[model samples]
Target: MNRILIDSSVHHMRIAVVENGKLVELHWESKAHQSIVGNIYAGRVENVVKGMQAAFVDIGQEKNAYLYYGQERATTDSNPKEGRKLKMGDTVLVQVTKDAVGEKGAVVTEELSFPGRFLVLLPEDTREIGISKKITDTEERNRIKEVLKDSLPEGYSAIVRTNGAKKSKEEYQKELDVLLKNCQAIQQFGQYAKPPALLLQEKSPALRIARELYASEVDEIVVNDRSIYEELLQAGEFPQEDGVTLLHYQDNTPIFEAYFVESQAEKALEQRVWLKSGGFLMIQQTEACVVIDVNTGKFTGKKSVEKTILKTNLEAASEIAAQLRLRNLSGIIIVDFIDMVSKEHRHLVQEALEQAVRKDRNKTVVVGMTELGLMQITRKKTRPSLEQQMSVSCRYCNGTGRYPSIDWTVSKMRREIESIFSNTIYQKVIVTANPKVLDAFCGKEEVFLKELQHKFEKTIVCIPMQAMAFDKYHIEKQKDS
Candidate 1:
C-alpha cells in the first residue's frame, strides 16, 4: 500500500511517501527558511546588461533575481517576436522557477504557470495542450487531450498532469477554473500593485504533496495535525470515489516514528548503507559530484565469483536510485560498480539503474559507463541536498575529515621551538597544545622534550590544553625561570 505520512506537529514540517511499507521519498519545509520557488512577484528591473542578454530584477528578496532575455531562452510571455527589451525601472510579472541556492539568486521566468491538482495553467501562450510523459497509456492520453481541447481560454495553454488521467471532464474543468481564477487574480492585482510586491504564494509543502497524489496508487493519506487533516478534506484535494482514506493520526507516538520513517530517514544521512545481501555501498558527497562505490562484503554466492559480483551490482543499482531520491542528492554522480568482464552483464546493470530511477520525481539522466569502469549520471538540482540542509561543516576537521597526524604535529613543534630559541634570548619556554599532540611531543618518558631542552639550553614546559586544536600550538617565552 502507498501512504503519505505528514508530520506537522514540529517546527519543520516533514512528509514521507511510503510504498509497500518502504520509504521512497522524503521532504521537509521549515518556517524559518521557507521556500519561494512557486511564488509570483511584480518585480522591478534593477539592472539590464544587454551584453549578457540578462536582467537583474529586484523581487524584494535578499538577492536580486536573474532573468534571462536571450532569444533562445526567452519564454512566450517575454515577447521575443516583438523584440521587447527589459530596462531599468520597468515592472513585470515573474514567477520563481528556482529558489536561491548558495550565492545564486532565485531564477525567475516571465512565463507564469499555476499548478493545480490535475493541470498546470500557462498564461499568454499558444494554446498548446501538453500531457505529462508519465501518462504513457495512448488511449488515456488521447482521452485527456480531447477533454481539455476547447476548455482553456483563447490565449491560455495548459499541461495535463499525470494524475489527470481517467479523471472526468468536470473534474478537469473544475481544476481549470480554479487555476484560471488564480492566474487572473495575479494579473489583475499586479497591474496596479507596486513593484517588488508578492502577488501569490504557493501552497504549503504538505498540502501541495497531497494535491499532487490524487491519481497515484496511494491509498492512505495520514496527517498528525487535526487542522491539516480538516484543511485537506475541506479543499477537496482527493477524490472521494478514488477510495483514498484520510486519517487523522491520534497515536501518542510521533507520526514519523510510528511509520518507521524516522529511522529510515536517519539512514539516508549516513555515508555507508549496508545491503540486505551482506554487501555494502560507500556513498560520498563531494563539492564536484556524488560518488558511490559498490563492494561485495561477505557475500559469496554458491555459484561463482562472477555471479556474486553481478548480484551485488544489480542490488546496488536499485539502492543507489532510492538513496538519490531519499537524500535529494543532485548534480553530477559517478558510480563505480563491481568489475564485470562480460559486456552483457554491464548492460544489464545499466538497464536496472535506468529503470529504478524512472520513479523519481526529479529528472535523472544516466550518461552510461566510461572506459575507466565508472558510470556517470546527472540529476537536476534546484535546491540544497538533505545533508547540506541538516548539517554544517565540521569546525575541528574543517570539513576535510582529516586532522594533522601526531607525528607531523610533534615534528613541526620541535622545529618551531628551535627557531624561537635561536631568534630570542629566552632561557625558558612554555608550549601549550592539544593533549594528544602533547603526548607525542613528550614521548614515552618525556625524552623528546628533554632532548629539545638540552639542544636549546632552555627549560621547556609543555602544557596540554584540551581546548586547543590539534593543528594549533602557542609558545610563551620567559627570561630564565
Candidate 2:
C-alpha cells in the first residue's frame, strides 16, 4: 500500500511518499527556506544585458532574478504588453519558473500560471483547453476537453492534471472557478503594486504535494500536525468516493521515526546503496551531472558469467530510477551499468530503466546508451537536489572531500610560523594547533619545538586544541610572565 506521511509538528515540515514499505520521494519546507516557484512577482528590471538577450530583475530577493526575452515570440500571450522589450527600471509582472540554486538567481518568465488541485490555470494563454499526456485514454481526454471547453472563460486556458481524469464535471468547474478568482486577484494586485513586490504566493510545499500527488495509487494520507490535517479536511482535498483514508497521527513517537522513514532518509543521503541481491551502486552528484556506477559485489550468481552480469545490470536499472526520485537527483544523469556483450541483453536493461522511470512525476528521458557502454538519461531540474538541500560543504575539506596530508600540513605550519616570526618583533610565541598536528609538529621528546625556538631565537610554546580543524592553527605572541 502507498502512504503519504507528513511530519509537520517540527520546525521543518517533512513529507514522504512511501510505496509499499520503501520511501520513494521526500519533500520538506521551512520558513527560513521556502520555494518561490509558481509565485507571481511585480519586478523591476535592474539591468538589460543585450549581449545575452536577458535582463536581470530585482524581485525583492538577495540575488536579482534572470528573465530571458529571447523566447518572447514562443511565449506570446493575450496581454498587449506581452512581448514588449524590457529596459532598465521597467516594472513587469513575472512568475518564478525555477528556484535559485547556488550562486545563480531564480529564473522568472512573463508567462504566469496558477496551479489548482485538478488543473493549472493559464490566464494569458491563447490555447483553449489542454490535457495531461498521462491521461492516455482518448475517451477520458475528450470528455475532460469538452467539459473544460464549455466551462472555461474565453481567452483563458487550463491543463487538466493527472488526477483530473477521475473527477466529475462539477468538480472541474468548482476548481476552475477558484483558480480563475485567484488569477483575477493577482492581476488586480500586480497593477497597483510597486516594483519588486510579491503579487501572489504559491501554496505551501506540503499542500502542493498532497494536491498534485494524491492520485489513484495513494491509499492513505497521514499527517501528524493537527493544523495541517484540519486544513486538508476543510479544503475538501480528498474525495469521499475515492476510498482515500485521511488519518491524523496521534502517536507519541515522531511521525518519521514511527514510520521507519528516518533511517531510510539517512540512507538516501549516503553515497553507496546496497541492493537486495548484494550488488551495490555508487551515486555521485557533480556540478554538471549525476554519475551512477553499478557493481556486482557479493552476488555471484549460480548461472554463467553473462547471466550474472545481466542480472546485476537489470537490478541496477530499477534501483537507479528509484534512487533518482528518492534523492530528487535531476539534470543530466549517466549510469554505468555492468557491460554485456550481447545487444539483446543491453536492450533488456534499457527497457527496464524506461519502464521504472514511467512512474516518476518529473519528466525523465533515458537517452539510450553511449558508445562507451554508459547509459545517458536526463531529468528536468527546477530546484536544488536532495543533497544540496539537506547538507552543506565540508568546512575542513572545502567541499573537496579530502584533507591535506599530515606531513604536508606540518611543513606548511612550519613555513607559516617562520613567516610570522620574521615579520614581527615579539620574542616569545605561542602556537595552538589541532591535537594530531601538534604531536607531529613537536616531534620526539619535543626536539622539533626546541630546534624551532633555537633557530628563531625566541621562546616557543605549542598548545594542542582538540577542537581545531585538521589543517587549521593559530599563532600569537606570548605576554611577558
lDDT of 2 by residue, 29-80 (tens): 6545788988899999999987567899999999999998765443444432
Candidate 1 lDDT tens digits, 1-481: 8999987732356778899889887776654577898899999999998866789999999999999876564465554432368889999899998877657899998989998877899996589999989899999988887888867788899998877778888888888888888889999999999999999987777787677655568899999888889889887767567778999997645676677676787676788999999999998888899999999988888898888999999999999999999888899999999999999999999999999999888899989999999999999986677776555555676776544444444555665666567666778889999998898788778877777677667788888899987778988988886
How close is every model to the real structure, measured as TM-score? Answer: 0.78, 0.80
lDDT of each: 0.82, 0.82
Q: Model 2, residue 44: displacement in angstroms?
A: 1.1
Which ranges in model 1 have alpha carbons more than 4 Å from their true place? 49-52, 71-84, 213-215, 399-481
Worst 10 residues of 2 by lDDT: 73-82
